[model samples]
Target: MSLARIYRGGLPSSKFIDVALGQGARLLIRRSSDRGIRGLMGRQSERRWIRMGHNLIQAGKAKRGRGMHTSGETDMQGKAKRGRGWAIALSVLAAAAVLGFGGYHLWLHRDVRVYVNGVPVDIRYRSSFGEICDEAGVVPEAGDLYSIAGNLIATGGGGPFTVSLDGVELSEAQLDAVEVEGGESFTVRDGDDAVEDSEVVERITAPRLVPAERLAAVTYVSQWGANGIDRVRVGAVSGEEILEEVVQEPRDCVLASVNPVPSDGRRLVCLTFDDGPSPYTAQVLQILEEKGACATFFVLGSNVGPWSDAIQGLEAAGCEVMSHTMNHRNHYATTSDETYRETADAFAALRDCAGVYTSVIRPPYGNWNEHCWISSRGTMSASVIWNVDSRDWELPGADAIVENCTSGIENGDIILLHDGGGDRSQDIEALPRIIDILREQGFELVTLSELMDADDRIPDEAARQYAPMPEDCAWPAQIAE
Candidate 1:
């Protein structure tokens, strides 16, 4: 390197070369003394390092090809200046970018004020209710009735919490995952003190059927069924529980079903008269005797004394006599006690007046109900109900009465006629014609007992036994007995 080029850059060429050589010798000496350098340069040649030192010397010398003030050297110096300017600009831009990003991030995550459990809380905007609660140090437990912004949220636990939001109760689904904005109020209270238990009426049980297997070929209801009642305590949490005492004890219907009627092909039909033993009783008896037919008379107990001769005549002529109650009251509307008394008196009267030991009674007006049936179970085997109506009480003329009696007369049917309720000249006139028409239709006119007796499958004792009334049936003790 020339001294002139070095002196132009303010350094002597010989000194610059001596400094380079001195630096190389110092580096080689340091490389040998330092263990890290020795390990790194163990395979490095000294000549190669010397060549690097020579290149450093060349870089220190200015490259002035034509003149000291040449355009090329000026251009090169200008380009180096521009490159440094660019590096400084790039450094300033990188620092500004970092500062801007940090500022934006700080602005984006702005703090928001929220009230949790009536305490003011400062947190980031759009924070969840759970996060707000956490920041406020308020932890909600089970059965806690808490509200957010006047909207209630209930937690499930051992109790039922009646929580409402803005005067409206919340459903079970809206109690979780609550999110809230800033400036909201919260409140909480224990539901146990606010809730009260309630009571409701409940049906205890339904009436059941009690069956009796051994009886005549008829169904008898010894006891009428009735439903029971009870009061139930309903808790807000526990639901329906703690049933109180039964309000009314349920009564089961005692249903005694006899063996099914046997189809013995005996075309027996019963002829029974209601409200009888009046003056028409003698006429009815004369008609039966003239037709050579036996019939049954449902004589009233009250009339049995005054009409004892007529009742005896009915009994002596092979006609069965049954009771029709003491007074002709509507058994359906009558109470059990009244029915029992009337039924007992009728039975006694029939037994005393005509020596008739029967177990049947025809309900007045043919309007019997379960009450009468249950009450009469003690005094009668079965209440005889008629299928064919003579319409004699209506006084629809004797021909019309005969038509009603014979139009649909089937085997094992009972024909109804009145002899004492009113004037029964029509019934007396229709009787002979009815007997003739029924006999012509191959139906043998018979009493109810006679028709029941034709079915030999029913035991004599069962037929004689009063309508299968169990001792335990739900009725008045006297009626049951």
Candidate 2:
């Protein structure tokens, strides 16, 4: 039998011992204090023996009997096995710590970003690059290239693109120029990489400028130009760009005022008679008829009842019959209700006389206040006033009436005269002479309505015609009776 050898485990000062011999090369052993046994094996050999002894111990093979007596070896073997298990546990813990730290670093610095026209975009927080571009008003189209930080990210070939966090894109490149068409926007990325790799996002575009065609022909009323002559930039939107040197002017035509004559290019004059339907109205109508002219007759409501036939004859002769109030009351001193009543009565009288409703209304003495408009509730007829006063009401002589009307008859003039306030014999006598003089001077006598109507600049021949009144001459009884 061979004696069993034993070696201590771990560190210096380890012990070695020998035990009793047994049969069949097995060792029966107990602790021995032999100092020489320690020296028998070198350090490396002792380590190897400790390893083998430990493996046997764990396998439950270390025993005293038929095999080698290995009590000393068994104790040393048990210690070595325990030490190996502790080393394995420490290695596993270190590996786990490294993996946990790496995972935390990846979570802390993650972000998605976008850019436009070299400008950083932060529209929707936590949104994908494509979603940010949509919010930034970016459109995709051909020949429009987009990049971020010198990397070409997207090539616009006139196709739609879907953006996502994981989408891959081209590298970043310097943007030399960027333009958008039809109010579209393009997406820009940090570099040519997938959306996940992008560090920043932006939208790129140029500011839109108003076209010259939009402001081409802006027509404006000049405070200094001739009456009714608006300073218009013809072809501003479509025509010429340099504004035609303000050379094109509008004809002289009356618009809203007493004599609103458009001063486009031609001269115009309006002749109006107030307090009419007296014997003078017929003479005035005859003169206008002979000269192919027209005039407005502001007839008193009472006068219409007596001279309805004559007024109708004047209307048929192309004259406009407007209201001068039932009693010619001073409108400035009248109440709101009185003004409405007076106006309504005058309208009723005129309609009774002419067998048709009249739209023209003139306040007596040109006396009107803001209340007159407000009280009527936007239904009171338009009030006509005069720009040129012939002072025919003052019994101006025939020569004076002609001079007064012609003197101020510029491009647009509404001349005022009386026809029926007491004896308008002077007006009757002066009308024919005035017509003759105006015709010779190339002045066309038009009603106030006609003069104002021409301000629209449409030719009279092209103007729409209204239906003429029936010959029955039946006034609606409710209006008159």
Candidate 3:
């Protein structure tokens, strides 16, 4: 059969054909039988007669036909070749279908969507409910349930809310909620004049008590004897009953010992430095040591390893070495467990390097929240915060540092200063003068733990008072020492 006369469909399904044509006045015909000519002519009778008369120079069939000749075996080979091509295409398509299905399944099941307060969140990865909530800016609530498509993913229970999700329950402290209450109508005072006749007063309270019990409890009992004085007893109680009576003494002020109220005696200041072990820290320590003053150094774990000698010197000089976390990351912006792990790692590193077990922690960037408490619960540490901040990190001059620090000196104040981070040259430069000024102003520089010793630094009580505040007021504006 001629190349033009070849029909692919009539070939056996298993055969594949390979055809090549050249530019020449020649024709080759191939068929399976002597009657092949009749079959080919019958299929296209009009074309067959014209083709045969036009190409009559070469008319014999051979194994390799080049001219007008007919061969049956060559026609069969072409049909088989065409069939094989179809089989190969089908095989390739089958492989592609398998890969496509596999990729689709991987994409569909790779990530999960998280929701907060009925709003869908783009988590895009498998992570704990606490992590998702942090990303969504949803402060976890005690007893709050986290679910995905009606299936519980985590449960909270302790800090402020108990979350339930995927059969796991995690307790987190809830954020403060704004509550509006009816009160006596008041007028707005603008420059001593009432601008509006009536003003609605709004009060914001912290979220309902976390599932965890208060760190301390208080009760008032009246004494009927000689002085007719009423005595207030503050106790550390468990959910079931009182664990220990904290203070049984009589006080003139009922709110006096209820909170960690600093005494109005001679000014007692706790100096706390974070991110330490820099070269400037040694100078700061030298000043503190010369003044016989002890301060709390919240050193980063990574800095400790490289500055072991410096850390040892600080400790030897009577400075308290505490944990500032393994990495100075924002605690409030991280997961509960991750925060816990970082804090734990810092503590572990301190213990390994400094041979000290410190229970004081200053969260990085001073970023703390209910989650920090939850993360630090049972970690044998108290969150130490500053009542006065010198803002030494601002690169203010030594005179400014002295002025800022001395400006807020008060009895039982915790002053925050930085010794690590970047250029603390200002801090080092200001330390001696600041110490002398504080002493001149009747302020005693002591470590945070020592300052807390004036009034017991109970973990629960400290946790409640150390709760997160707004970013604007996150760090105290002034320092006492």
TM per candidate: 0.46, 0.42, 0.43
Q: Flag the better candidate by TM-score, 2 or 3.
A: 3
Show model 1 residue runs off by greater than 4 Å: 1-262, 456-459, 462-481
Ranking by TM-score: 1, 3, 2
Deviation (Å) of 219 in candidate 3 = 21
Which has the higher lDDT value, candidate number 2 or candidate number 3?
3
Best by lDDT: 1
Residue range 1-481, candidate 2, lDDT tens digits = 1222332334111122111111111211112132222233234434544554354344433222323445767756754664464344334533543454344444333343445664555453334434555666765344433232233444552233332222334322212222222222334433223211222222221111111111111111111112121232323122322222333232221112223566454566767788877877777777788878888788888888889898889779888777787888887888878877887787778776667466456678887544454443323334567777888777767778778877745666677887778777777777777777776777777766566556664333222122122232111111101
Q: Local distance difference test, per candidate?
A: 0.64, 0.51, 0.53
Clashing pairs in 1: none
Write the residue-wise lDDT of candidate 3 on 207-261 in tens digits: 2113222221111111110111222222222112211322222221111112233
lDDT of 1 by residue, 350-446 (tens): 7787676766677787666545655664566566566677778788999999999899766677778888988888888778889899899988877
Candidate 2 segments exceeding 4 Å error: 1-259, 457-481
Task: Give the C-alpha lDDT of model 1.
Answer: 0.64
Model 2, poorest ten-residue lDDT window? 216-225
By TM-score, who's the top model here? 1
